[model samples]
Target: MRTLKQALLALLVLSSAVADLPTEMPIPEAFIGSPVGTASL
Candidate 1:
């Protein structure tokens, strides 16, 4: 149970990081060519 809680917390932190990515940039056509946008597709 303790390990599960830790895993959940880690997931929350990682989700926040992913959420921050789009907010950090416009993600325009230029970004689409990058790995991040391509992976999203």
Candidate 2:
């Protein structure tokens, strides 16, 4: 159980690190050409 908790914590940390990186990393240029839909909820 302790090891599982530690693994979950490690995963959470890694996900946060990835999300903190620049949002401008290369992506399909066409993705930007089409407007993103808005959320209604």
Residue 13 Cα positional deviation in candidate 2, in Å, after optimal superposition: 0.6
> Model 1: how large is the Cα RMSD against the reference?
7.6
Candidate 1 global TM-score? 0.49
Q: List model 1 lDDT by residue over 1-41, tens digit each.
A: 99688667655655565666667565465346554446546
lDDT of candidate 2 over 1-41, digit per residue (tens): 99688667655654565466567753333234323211111
Evaluate residue 17 in candidate 2 and report its C-alpha lDDT on the 0 to 100 scale.
54
TM-score for each predicted model, relative to the true structure: 0.49, 0.50
Instruction: List the global CA lDDT of all models.
Output: 0.58, 0.46
The alpha-carbon lDDT assigned to residue 4 of candidate 1 equals 80
Model 1 pairs whose backbones collide: none
